[model samples]
Target: MADLELLDKSIRRVPDFPKPGILFYDITSVFVNPEAFKYCIDKMVEIYKDSEIEAIAGVDSRGFLFAAPLAEKLGIPMVLIRKKGKLPGDTYSCKYALEYGTAEVEVHKADVEKGKKYLVVDDLIATGGTLVAARNLIEQGGGKVTDFFGVIGLPELNYEKVLAPSKITTLINYSGK
Candidate 1:
């Protein structure tokens, strides 16, 4: 694994972003640093290399950054879990709650094949709503969510409880912003 201390420093903390009194841990800084970006994916691969994952289900946008390369490295299929109406064909949708309101996510009905195992990837985990919803969409489409992986985790929110019974792995954790 890469030096987590140095990787943690690469992440930028921005306060009051998109709202008042909310400290946002911006991952864009990590994306710019090749070493940090590779470290994040390397650690994730190291952790799951032997898990026999058949596909990687990446939550929209930021999740694609890490998941795409990781899926390439692992030689597995990459499944996209997108927002409502973003997918073209038949899709399975799940509604999840955000801090302020609820949002919906969708996955193509054909992408999640039966008997395949998937790992859900995201940039970060706060309330765990998105990951939970992603897992639901995957299962509802006939694939199993083997695990949930994130580059960063905010344990202060106690997302572990919300994602109970399924394992969640993260490269770094911050108690608060």
Candidate 2:
């Protein structure tokens, strides 16, 4: 079994980050701690190791860190789900709401294969807007998102309801104040 207790303890919480009245759950600390990082990958690998995941779709920047190693371990290709304009050539893009504004994400047009199953990975799942947009972008390119995995989740943000019907997994969790 995964030692979620340790994972929880390893996480660093900072108050009033990016703006006041916001508590940021930083995953960078996990990257710094060898055991914490290993546990995250090990748990993720254990969860999807037996599945038919054609490719792993990592949701920009941080997601790439976890997805790359897991995809390699699972012997599957990893696809970049990047910010709009970050990827060149033809691409699939979608906009999603943020706490303060809106942001866009995209994937290379040729990366997604029709009817292929994919797993989306990210560092955190807060309001689920970003992941929802990522899923829509994948579907637009004819790829199906079988599941979504994140290192931390805040269900207080109603992420489950927002990402309904799709399997959502998180290694650590936090409740809102």
| TM-score list, all predictions | 0.96, 0.95
Instruction: Report lDDT per candidate.
Output: 0.91, 0.90
TM-score, model 1 to reference: 0.96
Predicted candidate 2 versus true structure: per-residue lDDT over 1-177, tens digit per residue: 357877887788889998899998888888888888999999999999998788999988899999999999999988998988898779988998898999999999899888989999999999999999999988998989989999999988889998888899998788974
Candidate 2 is scored at a TM of 0.95
In model 1, the Cα lDDT at residue 55 comes to: 95
Q: Count the backbone clashes (under 3 Å) in each candidate.
A: 0, 0
CA lDDT, candidate 2, residue 130: 91
Q: Alpha carbon lDDT of residue 11, candidate 1?
A: 94
- For 87-151, candidate 1 gives per-residue lDDT tens digits of 89999999988888999999999889898988999999999999999999988988888789999
Model 2 CA deviation exceeding 4 Å by range: none
